[model samples]
Each structure stands twice: as C-alpha cells, then as structure tokens.
Target: MADLEDPPVFLGFDFSSQQVKVAAIDGRLDVLHQSIVHFDSELPEFRTQGGVHLHGDGLRVTSPVLMWVKALDLLLDKMKTSEFDFSRVRALSGSGQQHGSVYWRRRASETLSQLDPDQSLHQLLQDSFSVSDSPVWMDSSSSQQCQDLEAAAGGAQRLADITGSRAYERFTGNQIAKLRQTRPEDFQDTERISLVSSFAASLFLGDYAAIDYSDGSGMNLLDISSRTWSEICLDAVAPHLGRLLGAPLPSTSVLGPVSSYFVRRYGFSAGCSVVAFTGDNPASLAGMRLQPGDVSVSLGTSDTVFLWPQQLRPALEGHIFCNPVEREEYMALLCFKNGSLTRERIRNQCAGGSWEVFSAALRDTPLGNNGNIGLYFDTMEITPAAVGLHRFDSDDTEVSSFSARVEVRALVEGQFMSRRVHAERLGYSMRTRVLATGGASSNKEILQVLSDVFNAPVFTIDVSSSACLGSAYRAAHGLVSESGVSFFDVVKNAPEPQLVATPHPAAQEVYPPMLRRYTRLEERVLQQRPT
Candidate 1:
C-alpha cells in the first residue's frame, strides 16, 4: 500500500455530448496529460418502412447500452502511442452530463475472472427493454412526460420543493415514466437503471448499477434532504419503476476496481480503485476551486450560472435545480437553454468573418452603443420560457435598426445581465466575484460585458477542461482513507489562473437601467402567452 504522503496518480473522464476528454493528475496535483477524442454525432437515418432511426451515437439501439468500449478503445490507443503509463494509475472516476440513464445486468459468474472483455451480455438483454439509445441529456422529447410526472408527484412546485428541481423533460424520472407509458413491455424488461456517470464507473469496475449523489440529484427521483430516492414520489408513478432505480452513493464512496479484463486490455495495473461518479457542473465547481462568494458561469450549448450557497433551498418559482456537492453545501444554479449556440449564430450573421473583427467592433462601439435608440439582444428570454423569444419586439422604442457592432454587444450584455439577475435572486451580494468557463470564456468582449454587468471581477482559467479536472480531483479525494488531503486543498494548490477582468466603471451605470428594461420586456412577453 502507498503511504499517505505518496498519493497515487488518478485519471478522470468527462463524458460530454460532443466528445470524451480524459485527464490525468499526479500526487502533487499537477495535470500530467490530457487527451480529447471526438465522436461524430449519430445522424438520423430515414428508412421508408421502418421510419426514422438514429444510430452510432455511442450505443446500439437494440440494447441501449453505452458503446464506450469503442470510445475507450480510441482513448487507450492514444494513451499507448503517447507512452503514458497506465500501471502507475492508482484511481479512476468520471464526471458526466446529468439526466441520462444506463442499464446493465449482473453476470451469473460472480468471479471477476468471468467478466470477459469480449462478452456481448448487453445484447442478450434485448428482450428486456427496447431502449435504442441512452437518451442524451439534450434530448427534450419527454416534456409532456415531465408534465405528467409533475402532476403525479403533486404539481410542479411541490415536486421542486421535494426534489430541488422542477421536473425537467430529460430528467431520469420523466424519462423512465415516458418509457413505461410508451413501451410498457420494455419498461418491465429493465432490471436496473443507472445514470451515465455511474454507468461509466461500472464499466471500469464490472458492476452493473450504482449512482452518485451529484448525478442522482438530477434524476427528479431523489429527496434533496434525505439524499435518497423519494418513496412517496416513486409510488406515485409506479413501485416497479422505483425498484429499478439504483441507490445514491456518496461522492467519496469507492465503488470497486478496474476489472481485471479492463486492466489487461488497457494495460493498467490491478487494484486501481474506481471511485463513484458525479455530475459535470459540480465537477466544474470543484475544478474551478469554487468557495463561498465565488460564481462560475458555464456557457455551453446551455448556460448555467452556479454559486456556492450558505443554505440549502429549493429552486425559486422559475429556477429549479440544486447543487449536488454535499448534503450541507448548497449551490444555486440559473440555466438558460440557449447560450453559445445563440452567440455563434449572431456572430455568423453580424460579425462578418472573424471573432477578431467582432471584438474590434464591440470595443470601438461606445458603452450602451451611444444610447442606441432601439437596440436589444434577446438571445432567447429567460422569463416566460418561450422559444424564439430572441426576436426584436416592434413595440419597444429602444431601437429601429441595429448596427453589426450594436447587435454583438447586445447579445453579450443580455447573457451577462441574466446572470446578474439570477445571482441577485439567489441572495448573492454585489461583492461576489464571477469565475467564467466554457466557450464564452474565450471571448474577451463577453467577459468584459459579464464583469460590467455584475460589477465584479471575472477570472478565467487556462485549462479548458475544468469539468474533467474536477472529476479527477473527486477521484483522488475518494481514494483518501487515511488522513488524506481535502478537495479544496488540492484545487487551491493546483494551478494559477490566466486572465482576470475587472468591471468597467463607466458601463456599470448603463447596465442597471438596461437590465431593468430587459426584465420588463420578458414579463410582458410571458404575460401575453396563452395559458
């Protein structure tokens, strides 16, 4: 056994929608090596008689098993070519996108030796469920199902109060209920269901089912206070479905080992402990070294502004999601469905050809675009939850036409202001600092707007893969059995941040009125919607 002073090297995996990123960290908390493997999106193929079917998105439609074997094959090949030793790897774990479920069956042969690398056991379970693809977190087809579950569990508010989130379409409970209603035969076939994070961990350990608190919290089946599945809520849907759900494991629990088969195939040494998994957001927070008063704004396809909170509270009326960091620690998260993609669209349409040109245009344009007569960037309104709400309102007297520069600034400012309002609602004071990540963090213009809107400093780390690093940190912390170091200690001493942006005092005054106007517009739009 290694001495407590000689902490073992750990590997963390971030299983994202676009790609799989693998990162390794040494005992001193230095990132040793990192690699990213991209997977082509499974395009929907139309079959005249069979209807439309999608394939090749990391799974077989017949069994719905995650085809990480292919992804792992590519990753391991890369590692081998790079001459990264797998033998010294002491622990492994992962951070995965939340809300996805994976199902697996326990092999009859309990011995670790019987778990063959080439076994197609997942295929044999086809008769159990017709799950074709592990529904990615981005799949929102279960909206109606979410509504049903909300009603079943006692209205949206009650469900939010209990689960710490309003039932989302992609959440596990809604997805399970949808499966049960649409394909009763398949639902009955399911022996066990697990989140993608847990499933990835299982792959390394040869265990079929186990869930981590961070990922389980996103399921809409978990009781926030108890940190367990809600029996009353489960019974409201179906007791059988509840039986299929896995128990929630703490973030620090050591699930098992990298199975011998995996060890042999990947060239990793035996006894490499595999820690339980967690959701990507909490992992990002850990990676960024977030503490009280530190806010991280993750701007991916969907944008989420998360901050550590002093107390655990349910999501407000419109906002519904909680941080799964720990039972006592709280995270207030504000999410927007349209984030980077919307910004990209605007860049393509208005910024001519380059981000440099866009930045230059934004810089040349004065604060508030010289009090632009009729300019506002919608970028999808946060309130009223209406799709395509980014369009300009003719009734607003602000602007008649927007220049390319004005349009760019409006989009940047809109997103920042949204974060500001969300943080305020969460009871964060103006003194809080904002730490930014994801695609938007790369844009200096956006960061400036973020700083100005929040009237706080914005810091960006050099590492693009914060979520993966966070996962590795969790794995390392989980491996500590004897007087090990804390996660905060690890991250605090890990690396130095690169860029920091301070708020532009001149623009601070301009943003407050603009934010107020934006809120009014949002309310009007929602009120006009037909109930």
Candidate 2:
C-alpha cells in the first residue's frame, strides 16, 4: 500500500498517429496532470506530415522510430518542468495506434536489456532497429501479401474465423510478409518484431515486453480464442515466426518494475509496475467504462466505431479484437478514413469554414435530408474499400450534386448511416445504447443525426483523451485485478456518461426506408469504382 499522505498515481500514455500524449490520475480516478508532444511541430527533422511519411506510390506509409523515441524524451522533460512527482507513480500502461509494427536488429534486445541512465534513449538506440521507418496503420501497400495469407488459411472467411478479422493490408502479418519478401536482407538481419504497443512497453521494462492479446489480435497472426500465435498463420508469414513474436500475455499482466534507468534519471519509483499495453481502440473502450450492451463511436481525424459484442461475428469488412479487460469477450471495430477532415472540407465549401454555420444547415434541413445521400472519402476508406465523393437522390439515382445545406445534412447522415450498416453486419442491433467520444462528439447537431440514424440515445463522457485516460484506468485496474475485482468495479466511481442526444420520435418512421435506399446507393457506388 502507498502512503496516505501522498496518494499513488497511475500514468497512461497514448502513442497516437499525430502525437504522443500522457495523462496522470490520482487514486480518486481524477485527472491530475496531462501533457503532449507533437511530432510534426516539435520534431520537424523527421519531415513527417501528420506524423507519417507517405510514399510516392501513395499506398505505403511509415513513421520514424527514433522520432517516437525522441518524443518520449521531450514529453517526460515537459512533465519534469511541470514539477510532476514521478516518485508517486504506482503503475503505468499505454496504448498505440493499431497495426503499426517495429523491427529490432540482431543485438537490439541486448542493448535494451542494458540501457544507460546517463544517455538519452534516442542516442543509445539510434541503430538498434533493423527498419528505421516502421509501417503504420495508414499503410495499404500489402494487397498481394493479404491475398496470399488469406489463401494460405483456406480463404477469407475461414481466416476471419480464426483471427477475428480477415487479412487486411495494414495488419502486421501482411506488413511483415511484405517486408520479408521485398527486403530479405533486412528481414535476415532482424532478431524480433514488436507491435507498437509492446515496443513502447519495452522502453519502460528495460527489455522486450510480451505483446498483449488485445493488440496481437490486430495483427492477423494470433488466434483470438486460444490467445496464442497460430501455427498455420506463422507458417504462412515466415519460418519460425512464433519465436520472433514472443508469447502474448493478458492486458492486465504486469511485466515487471520500471527499468532502473528511469529510477536513476527520471525519479520513477523502483517499485513502479509496468502493465501490458494494448491498441488505442481497446483502451478507449476501457476508458469509456462501457456497459455490456453499449457501442462506442470515436469521431476523430479518422472515425472509428467499436462495440463489446456478446458473440464474435467474423467478417471481412470490420475488425474484432480480444477484449482488453475481459478475457472471455471480444470487441468489434469499423474505421472510416474520411471523418473530421471530410467534414471540414464540406464545412469550408458549404458553410465558409464555420462549424456554427454547418450546424445551422443541419438544423434547417429536415430529417433524412429530403432523400439526398452523399459518401465523401477524401482518402481511401477501409470499411467499404472505396474512394471519392458520391451522391444519390431519393429515387436511388446518382446525382451530380446537391444544395449546400442539403449537402451538409447529407454528409452527416450518410456518415452515421454507414456506421449503422457496417455495425449491423457485424451482429450489432439498433437497440444498444451509444457512447460517443473524440473531437467531434461535442457537436450535438452531428450526434443528433447519429442518434436518429441508429434510433438510440447518444451519451457523452467528459474525458477528452479517451485512449490516454483508458490506459490510466487500466493501470489502476491492473493493480487490483489479481484479487478478482472487475474493471467496472474499479472505475465505478468515475463520472457518469451524460445524455447528449435522443432520437426524435419520428426517427423510427423516417430512417428505415432511407437506410434501405442508402444501402442500395452504396452498392451502386462500389460498382462504379475500379477494384
């Protein structure tokens, strides 16, 4: 037990797409401190736009491993300048952008096992990685590798049944296969591979950290049911692939105490425990403290919808991962590439770059947007695998365009309706409640459309950084998990999710027919695209 005078604090970190963020929470579960390090602005030497380098081919994307390391150094120094009491930290955990992967050189583990307190991590581990530029979730260059893996596992649906998701180009398994086949010399020189989540854990543990099952399930390499690496999937990727990726542990497992380097340099307590990290989406689910029948929709730069499903429904469209906090359960996710930026584009074009104007347009248009629907993807979308702007009228006929006000309502409605359609395909029902988080969740006008589309009440939480806060909650829960206290019990005292929007009574009448028409229009859009 910690001293009563100074309550123990739990730390949560999020290595997101654009930045690395940290949040500290006291024993009462209230946020005590928060900080961030932006990659593009803070570390311009890496030359990253949106914290990633887009290849000339437009499908390949990567981030500098050293830039991530350097960002940590900057973040901790910022905390130190803020006079944060690192000595009071009891346990720490984090979340990483899903599907990003890191490769270690032959002697990198040896270097990690013996880090020096005097030298910064960036200096000591400058040459430790076999591949300096790690492939991230935005990457989509491994289509051939995806097809090959699916065929090896006896087709798409069969593989989905085993791994909780069908082979996706961004999944780590396909990324690894692409690297091994395309860069054989680099592959031969590599000793181990770590998901971005475990790679960050390794930095704190002073050695390699076991990949948690929740993050491993995103790789298309782990068997979701058995919680172990699949032999067939292993054989399909590379020889002796199981050994490269160490045995995965539960998300709550404590790897060990923080490395002595932190104790000597940053004043972290020697007894501070380092908990296994997980993917950002899973961490958000934990942070929201979702109930059994709740679905979470995160409206960020790239919108994502996830749910704690009663049963696993394997599909090619979305993803299912091992639940971060519950061993016997699973969570499903759907990603939309065009979320905030797409909304911003429409707002600029239709409303002169004012969100208030955008909201007014939504209010002016009637429900269903008078049967106008639009699908806008500024970039390639993952869910339906389509790109570009598409519009349709009430008769299900493709249209050149719509009025600006109609376009605004159509865009918001189309986004939520697609979420409902894809979610239903994965066994989610309309009756489940919604917990909306992320930057766009504060927009009641947008959430009203979401509520109407799903015909469910929309709830909002107060936390701004769900992924980071979720990691802190997990850090606290990990301390009590061995004694059998449920995660819900641990976070029960946290603020209640506030009711933000409820469906209009007439929503039940207007949406059913509109949804049917939208589905047909979506099929037409897919047919027009080049596969």
Candidate 3:
C-alpha cells in the first residue's frame, strides 16, 4: 500500500443519464470519497420554447451548450466543497453512455471554452440537421438507416462479415448517414465527430480528438482486428458525411494536461493528466475485475453482459460486440435495452403492485411459474440485428394488450433466455459464473431469478460504482512503473464482493423447457417481416 501523506488519487467520472458520478481512489484502489450530482434540462426555466420539435425519435430540444458547461462547473463546485483536495486528484478518466456524437469545427485557439460559448455553432449545425437533438444510443428511430445499410452491404450476414458486427441505428455510422441523407447541409458543416466519452475528455485536454478503442468499437465503423476506423466503413460513410473520422487510442494513453483555462476555472492542479475515456460497459468490466471465463452483467438503464475473450471470434450471430481491452486483449459483449425497465413495469402493473409485493409474488410463483407462462421482454434488442420494433403476433397480440402476471413472467424469462442463446452462439460454455452489477442486481428477487435462469452463480461486488472503480484501477496502474505493480494485482487487491446467489435446483430443472420456448419465439419473431 502507498503512504497516505501524498498517495496518488485516480478520479473517475461516470457521466450517466440520471447523474454524473465522480469517485476518487488511492493507489491501493481504496475508495476515498464519491459524489453524485444530478441535472435535468426538463425544468421549465431550462426548457427551450420555440426552438424545439418533438421528432419521431423523441424530443428534439436544444439548450445552449453552456448548459452542459455550467452543469460540469456545478459538478466540480460540489466536488470542491466536499473537502477532497483537487490537487491530490492526479490522473482523471471517465466512462459515458455509448453512441452519442459531439461535433465541432476544427480551428486553432477555439478551446472548449469558445466551443461551449458558441451557441451559433450549435444553432448553425442544428438548422443543418433540422433535427435539434442528437440521437442517443437509446434512440431507435434509425431503423430505416439500419435497413439501408443492410441492403447496401448485401444483407445482415454480409454486412456482419465485413464489419464484424451488424448494423444498429445507434451506431455512429448510421447516425452519420441519417444526417447526411436527411440534412446534407449539416453533414457538410461537420468538421469532426466524437463520441460522448471522448467529447468530455476533449473538454479537459482542449484539442485531442482521440477516442478509446472500447468506445470506438461501438461505432460499428471500427475494425476489431486493426483497432482503427475501417477504410471500407469510412468509404461507405464518407460520401454521405463530411467530417474526418479520428483514430482510436488505447484506453491508457495520457491525453495531456487539463487545459490551462480549465485548471484556472475549476481550481485544478497543474499537470493533472487526463487519460483516454471509454464507454461505461468496458469500464464496468474493468471494475468487476473480470478475467477469462468471468462475465460481468451490468443492469443499468440497459442490461449488458461482457466476457473477456481469449481472442476475437465473430460468433453469437452478430450479437457479440468485440473490442480491445488494453492492447491485444479483447472483450465480448451482449446488451439488452429493456432490462430493469421491463421488470419495473411488471412490478407496477402485474405483480400485485409495488416492488416488495412483486418479490413476494415471485417467491410464491414457484419455479417456471408452474409452466403456465413465459415473458417476452423486448424493450431494447436492436443489436445482433435490428428488429425495427416490437410486434406481437395474433397469438401474442393479446399478451401485449395489457400487462398480466404471466405475461410479465414471460417477458422476464424471455429476456434471460435470449441472453442465454446469445452466449451459447458465441461459443461460451455454461461453466462461466456471472458477476452482476447495477441497480437491478441489488434486488434479491431479481438476482435469484437470474441465478436460476442462467444456472450460474451470480456475484455482486462490494462497490456500487464498479465502472468508476475500474477506471481508477486503470489510471493508477498507468501512473506507476509497469514493472512494479500490475493491473491484475490492483483488481486482485480490491475489496471483496457483497453477495453471491446460486441457482435453485428446481428452477434449474424447469429452465430447459423455457429456454426452448424462448428460442422458438425469438426465431419466429426475427423471421417475420415488420408490419
């Protein structure tokens, strides 16, 4: 352990939808203190009046870019008040929700300050796209975009063959295409495009345009083997868009010192290095201290399962997202859009009302709901192949009419079974245990259900902010001599987990039939043409 007098403190920022969580950890990966600051643009005063439009994607509202600037400012202000010395915060890094792009025109002396204050630039680009809001990863309106790309690249299988992944509307490539096809003027004006994670880092470092491989891979334009934007992808996309795609940097690269302006504005120490940023999923994988055969299941706004692969293999019928870990090391990933939200909806409408009552009802429902029903949770399942939208057939149409207990059970069971099929398709055997994290994993009933469904031990770590903790681990390992201490050692030395849930035998016996039903439903659903 390092001495407390001046031990290095690695700071990790998790820029989430609900809150921005900032955490600091010492050299030994011990938590120092953490702060969560919340902000909402939905307030009447914060909301824009005439400039916004309710696009098919969602609300296309424009706030002055300064809102983000002020939000970060307030976040730092709160951090300063917490008594944690900003100087001790040596290296800084972050994890953000994936796929949202921040565009900027390249110009010397146009620091983030100038960029932030320039409402005209935002308005100019906004007018160009005519769609004010950037389509976040959660936005699924890119169905048309996905279809076009699939047709152009010779169907889903062919496109997956070239890019090593299927087309998803949330991917940077599709969003760029959407802008180019619909808003040519805006597409031409875009000088550079960046992911949200890299954009936040650029705020501190001033001019760096590098994106971490983890976030870059999510763009569906990045080549997994080369770990760079694919020329083929660029060629396919560049004709429609104008901005130059940036090269991907390793997660550990020192971006540069915090901008002198930011240092003065936020009272940060000089020479504080800002490391490259990654998506929350990759960061969470690091936080969970994942190893080969070790899977990390994050149950956030969405649900994701990540496994450290020995090597990259394009398996799982394109359900797998393969990206680099450090250098040659890679990660295999599966994400579900409707995870906790589905469960919450069930609790509210079907499970006798309230989460407490839902848990009690689930306990009494017995294994497999006595084989009377199954659930089809499809809140988010765009990846592997974009299904466009949910459409329950004649038989399932009644299932969607109203929320019922059996229907909810079917939805939950269906989602878990979908994940199982995905895992199996990726050539992952059932021997691996799952390390579950996020809000959903905290619920005892959900964990038990997951345990029984997957038939694998589900373990929850002691730290709630696993992504931040993992980023801290990466930052600390990057600072000291490589030979002195290893990244694995940092993970190994981290605190013990909070709980472990093993599968119940009765449920385990019942899962096989449920799994078969789920496979049939998924196959039938995917095969049917969208109405």
Top candidate, metric TM-score: 2
Q: Candidate 2 overall Cα lDDT vs. reference?
A: 0.91
Best by lDDT: 2
- Candidates in order have lDDT scores of 0.67, 0.91, 0.64
User: Model 1, which residues run further than 4 Å from truth?
Assistant: 1-7, 41-66, 77-83, 105-113, 117-132, 263-267, 300-302, 311-313, 316-327, 341-361, 364-384, 387-399, 402-408, 481-484, 506-514
Decide which is better by TM-score, 1 or 2: 2
Question: lDDT per residue, candidate 3, 314-345, as tens digits?
Answer: 64254334442456666777767777776777
- C-alpha RMSD of candidate 3: 5.7
Deviation from native of the Cα of residue 428 in model 3, angstroms: 3.4
TM-score of each: 0.82, 0.92, 0.79
Per-prediction backbone clash count: 5, 0, 6
What value does the lDDT take at residue 348 in candidate 2? 99
For model 2, which pairs clash? none
**Rank ordering of all candidates by lDDT, starting from the highest:** 2, 1, 3
Tell me the TM-score of model 2. 0.92
Clashes of 1: 5
